[model samples]
Target: MRKILLLPFIFLPVILFAQGQHTLMDTLRAQLEIVFKADQQYRLPLEGMAKKYGWNSHQVDSLYEGMSIRDSIDLGIVTHILDTYGWIGTDSIGPSGSTTLWVVIQHADPDVQKKYLPMMRTAVAQGRAHANELAYLEDRVALEEGRKQTYGTQFQLNKKTNKYIIAPIEDEPNVDRRRAAIGLEPLEDYARDAGIAYKLPASPPAKPAQGPDKNP
Candidate 1:
């Protein structure tokens, strides 16, 4: 008589691998590391161009135009893979993959983000993922689809008008509560990090009353 034992294999296509087991998360971390580096590679050039050609110059616009297509494609492919694999969290993939996923989602175009939002929301609801991803995407989706953002990440300055265009937040009064629920810092802190001057709108001057004139 002989006895045989079988050993488990290290799977490559797993979605919920724990930290440091050479699983799918390694691939995710590797791919996103390259992506993050590529993103940073443009920063110095952009800053130099801004200094030389002016911040709002046509050259900057051209740079953005060229990058937009590549950025969209990169995000599209990555997000598609993510959606297929289901949402992975810090508990499953460890800090590297978790941080990389967050960065990728943040850099992704709003449309791409909206496309993957359902999976992310599911993860949150299932207690496998953090709520911040959902909160961030909710705001991005609202801005792109012309509704109120819930987390307020879509602020921009209109260069021509020299005014801020803040994406509306639903229930502005308790926005901090929503943010806290999702593990985000105070709105003021986030605004400062994003370089926004959150201000209360100034009151308009009262209109002068018109006087009645009588013809004699």
Candidate 2:
């Protein structure tokens, strides 16, 4: 979607001697924060503009080009961290740090998202990651794979209508319950922020799932 360049970038020398892994994690956390801020700088401003003037195709394209560059760079760092240390969870890097990892992966291509989905699931089970972020990533991946999303977190801008709408969701009427389980606001509520007046299906609500979706 949308993806900062903190000059004096992430190339700082990492001292891992007697300081141990904690120091290494702190450095990584700082790097993650830099990447997270960069990820937002372009997209947030563009989102504000879209809300004010509606989506301008040229502006959206320009913003995405910038975001894609940052996203690729961020993804490289995230992939290296994951490869070297496995998933750095909240316990090791704190909530914001863990979220930065998820954010990069979520913005990655579908193949990259699929590659790391299982590890993220385990991170969630261990309480090292936020379920809400997992829900968003899960919905994104599912939509890319031609499947119905679970949390209704993925939306598409209908070029014709010039509006945002939730992507297809499984058991649509019960999506709110599924979202609630993972700490996401209701779909309708989330949509409103994007200027979408979302409405649930007329069908009766289905029984809630035992937990978040079991599929990967």
Candidate 3:
């Protein structure tokens, strides 16, 4: 009988610890939900936001598929944001919308909050910047990829001359081939005049031999 009574006492601390952890996690989730919802209000989808952060679209979608906005905003996510972006000002905007939560935390925890508050701000800023840069880089890559697909390797011959040549499109290279298979002069000149930089391929396609070969 005594052992049974003592059993509850022994497990009390464990119970309390579990409860405290759960409460803290719940609180964090609630706060995060607010932030996530606010972000959505601005027309930013979580998938797009994740992509901006350099996350694969599928991975991000899977993570948030069944998660509520509240659950997604947990303490872990907040900490991640803080670690990435620097803490500069609490009132500043964040990727997930306004930094009102930071301000609230500062007001509520004052002394204790000061220690990690800067980290949170820092993470938010860094995360935002990183996402933006990734988005821009992806756009450029997609454009280049599209251009390559649209323009095949062969350059059509439009005109030809010893000193001057013109092609239907620009050919890639540096060779003595006078077949005007989209000569590089226009591209090179345009790049120079427009202050753009580009390099010609090392070898040009060989020009078709003039007339049929005698060696049937």
By lDDT, the best candidate is 2
lDDT of 1 by residue, 118-214 (tens): 8777877887666776677678777778888887666866889787666677777677787888788877787777667675333466799988877
Going through the candidates in order, what is the number of backbone clashes in each? 0, 3, 14
TM-score of each prediction = 0.68, 0.79, 0.26
- Model 2 C-alpha lDDT per residue in residues 96-139, reported as the tens digit of each score: 99999998898888899999999999999999999999998898
Model 3: CA > 4 A from native: 44-77, 80-216
Task: Give the lDDT ranking, best first.
Answer: 2, 1, 3
Q: Distance from true position, residue 101, model 2, in Å?
A: 0.3
- Cα-based lDDT for every prediction: 0.69, 0.86, 0.43
Tens digit per residue, CA lDDT, model 3, 69-90: 4333443455564555444232
Model 3 RMSD vs true structure: 20.5
Worst 10 residues of 3 by lDDT: 148-157
Q: Candidate 1, after superposition: displacement of residue 196 in Å?
A: 2.8
Q: Which stretches of candidate 2 lie over 4 Å from their true place?
A: 1-18, 49-62, 202-216
Query: Top model by TM-score, which number?
Result: 2
| Candidate 2 Cα RMSD after full superposition onto the native fold (Å) | 12.9
lDDT minimum window of 10 residues, candidate 2 = 1-10
